[model samples]
Target: LDIAFIVEGSDNVGEENFNIVKKFLERVITGMNVGQEDIHVTVMQYSETVTLEYSFREIQSKESIIEKVRSIPYQGGKATNTGNALNYISKHTFTLVNGGRQDVPHLVYMVSSSPSTDVITRPPRSINVIPIGITPNANIQELRRISQPNNPIILHSYSTLIEEAPELVLQSCCSRKLWTEIPELCNKPMDVMFLLDGSSNIGASEFEEMKNFVRAFIESAEISNTSIHVSVLQYARENNLEISWNVPQETEKLVEMVHSIQQREQGPTRLGRAIDFVVQNAMSESHGGRPSASKVAIVIVSGRSEDTVEAAALSARMNRVSLFPIGVGNRYDEEQLRTLTGPSAANRIMKLQNFEDLSTMITLNSEFIKKVCMDPVRECIDEDGNKKKPGDKWTLPDQCHTVTCFPGDYTVLESHQINCERMPKPVCHSNLPAVKIEETCGCRWMCPC
Candidate 1:
C-alpha cells in the first residue's frame, strides 16, 4: 500500500495544532510496517502551494520516517489550495518513478480546517482520497465531493483526531490477504517447470522456505498430469531433477517429492547451465512436456550467476518456453535478472529481500501461470512499445500480457495506452489478430478496431 498525507498548513492552523498533526502522523507510522514491499508513506504540506516534506522512496524505516516527520517545518500560507495539491499529486507524485506501483492501492488523506480555493475534480489516476477535517469550520460538503463514495469523512478536532489516528490508519492499511482472492483458471493444460537455486549462497534454511513455497503453489493449483504437468529441478553448478513431468497425476505425490527434495549446496551459481538443462531435458515431448500445452520455466536465483544466462534463457523461449526469473536476495544482479526474464521485467522478475519472502511468490506464481495457460498465444512487443510485426518471431517475457487484434480487411487503427474494455466493440475487417484481453492491464499489445 502507498499512502500520502496531505496536511493543510494554512494560517488558520496554529503551531500547536500543526505539531499535534505531526504527532498523529508519527503514531500512525509507528503502528505500520514501512518497507519496500509493504506500506510506504509520504507527507506533503499544502497551503497556497504543495510542499513535498518527504517521499516514501527516501524513507524505508519507520524510525527514519518519524524522525523526518518531526523535523518538517510548518509551511503556513494565506489560504488553502486543496485542488491544486490534488492536481500536483496526481500529475507528479503518484508515479512509478516515485516508488508507486500501479497494481497496489493508493490512498491520500487530506487534513484541513478550511474550504478549498478551487474545485476538486476527479484525478487522472485511481486513488482513495480521505478527507480529515480538523475543526467544525471544515467544509463537509467539499469533503464529501472530494472523498471516495460512501467513505465517511473523519471529522474531529486536532486532539481527538490524534487519539483516533491509529484506528483510522489501520482501516486504510489493513491486511490485503483478502485482496489475493483471484479466480482459479481450471482445466488449463500446462507443462510448468521450476528451476530452483540451491547454491551455498541460498543456505539450508532459505532452501527449505523455497521448497515450502513450491509446495504451497502446488496445493493452490488445480493440478493433474492431464491438466497441469509439474516438474522441479534444483540447480547450482549442476542441476538435479527432483520431480519429472511423467510423475503420477497425484497432487499428494508431487507435494511429497517437493518436501523430500534436499539442497544441492556448495556449487557455483551456474544458472546458464541450468537454463539449458531445462530446455534440452525437461521441455521435450519425451519428457511429458506437451507442445500444445503452455510451457513455462520459473528460475529462482539467490545470487549472481557464475556463467552467462541470457543466451540459454533465450534458447528456452525460442523453443516456446516462457521464462520467469525470480531474484531472491539483494546480492543478485538486477540487470541480469531482467535479461533472463525478458520484457515486462516488473511482472517477470520478482526481487525478494530474503528466502522467507518466497511465500509471497506462491500467489503471484500461481496466478501468472494460470493466466498464461488460459491463453498461451503471447505477442512480442518492441522497444518502442509497439507490437511486433507478424512472422517477426520473438519470445514473450514471463508474465507478458498481450491482447491480439483482429484486422480483417478494414484499416487497423493503432491505439496506445487505452483500456481494452473501453475500446470499440470488435468488428473485424482487417488482417490483424483478434484483441484478447488479459486479466491485467500490463499488456501493451495492439488492440484492433
Candidate 2:
C-alpha cells in the first residue's frame, strides 16, 4: 500500500497545534507495518505553498518515517490551498518514479483545520482521499466533496488527533484490504432484499440519493441468477414491491429499474409492517428466493416507525434472514435500529448523519457482501431431533462427553476428555476416603463415608 499524509500548515494551524498533528502522524505510522516493499509512506505540507516533507522513495523504514514526520517544519502561510496539494500528490507523489506501485493501493490522508480557499475537484479513482477535518472552521461539505462515496473523519479539536490515531490506522488498512478482496468475496449465492423508506419525510431528492446508493451497491456485487438475486420494496403507509427477484434480469436492466423508481411520499413510516410484508412475499421461494441461498435484508429507514419492529425483526432472524438496518438522520430512533438486527447490532446497523451521507455508504458494499457470504447462518440438530444454533453447547445424559454446535454445515463437536485439574475436588463426609474414578482425559473423585 502507498499512503500519503497531506497536512495543512496554514497560519491558522498554530505551531503548538501543528506539533499535535505531527504527533498524530507519528502514532499512526507506528501502528502500520511500514517497509520499502510493504507500505510506502509520504508526507506533504500545504498552505499557499505545497512542500514535500518526504517522498515515498525517501522513507523505507517505519522508524525513519516517524522520525522524519516529527522533525519536518510546518510551512506556515495565509491561504489553505488543499486543492493544489491534492493535485500535486496525484501528479508527483504517487508516480512510479516516486515509489508508487501500480498494483498497490494509493491512499491520501488529508488533515486540515480549515476550509480550502481554492476550488477542489475529485481526485483520480486510483487514489482514495480520506479527509480529516479538525475544529469548527473545517468545512464538512468540502471534505465530503473531496472524499466522494467515502465518509470523511471529523475531529472537533486537534487535541484528539493523537487519541484517534489507532482507529485511523485501522480504517486505512481495512479500507485497502476490502477494496482488494471485494471481487472474490461477492461471488457467493445470496438473496438480497432492499427495503426502502418512501414516506413524506423523505423528499424526492433524498430518495434519489437512496436509489443511487442501491445502484452503486448492486453494481459492486456479482448479480446473476446463480450468484446474487435482488428484490426492491418501497414502504411508507403501504408497501410497494418495485422489483421482484423472480424476474431474471441483467445487471444493466436491474440498475435501470432502480433508477426509474419514483418516490411514494406518503405518511406514517410503517417499517415493521414492511419487514413482515417482505418476509412473506419478496423472500418466498416463489419469488426466486433460493432455499439454499443465504438471506439478507437491507433496510434504509429515513424516519422513526409508527409500529413496533421487534416482532417482525425477530421473525426475520428466526427464518434465517440477516437484517441490516441503515437509519438516516437524527430523527431515527436508535433503539429501534438496534432492535432490527438483534444483539449483533454493531456489525449490522448503520446510522448516517443525513440523507446526503447515504451515497457514502456505497463504499460498504464489500462489507455487506463479506457479512452475508463469509459469516452465514448455520444450525445443528441433535440425536433427540432438537434444533441448535451456532455457539451452543450441551452435555449428554451420561455426562461423559460434551457437544458443541459450531457454525458452517451443522458442525457438531463432541469431546470425551475432561480436565480434572481444573475441576473442584470432591468433599468426603465423616473423614472418609475419596475414590478416584478414571475417565478418558482425567479422573473424577467419588466420596465415601
Assess the local accuracy of residue 218 in candidate 1 as a C-alpha lDDT between 0 and 100.
Answer: 71
Per-residue CA lDDT of model 1 for 163-269, tens digit only, reads 86556556544643212333456576788888888788777767877886676567556686556778998898778888888788576788778878988785689
Where model 2 places Cα greater than 4 Å from the true spot, the runs are: 11-16, 99-103, 113-116, 119-123, 134-151, 174-181, 188-191, 194-270, 280-295, 300-321, 325-368, 374-449
Backbone clash count for every predicted candidate, in the order shown: 16, 0
lDDT of each residue in 1-449, candidate 2, tens digit only = 88888999999998999999998888888878788668888899999979888887785898888878879987799999888888888788888898778888888888998999987767887787778888679987678667754546767689878886446555645445633424656466788888888998888867877886777566656787667888899999999989988776576788779979999887889999999888877789888789978888889987789999976875576566788888888888888887787654447788788765565444533555566566544445443547877888877545655667767635444547667666776677757767778885567878875
Give TM per candidate: 0.47, 0.60
- The lDDT values for all models are 0.70, 0.77
User: Clashes in candidate 1: how many?
Assistant: 16
Candidate 1: RMSD over Cα atoms?
A: 23.1
Model 1 earns a TM-score of 0.47
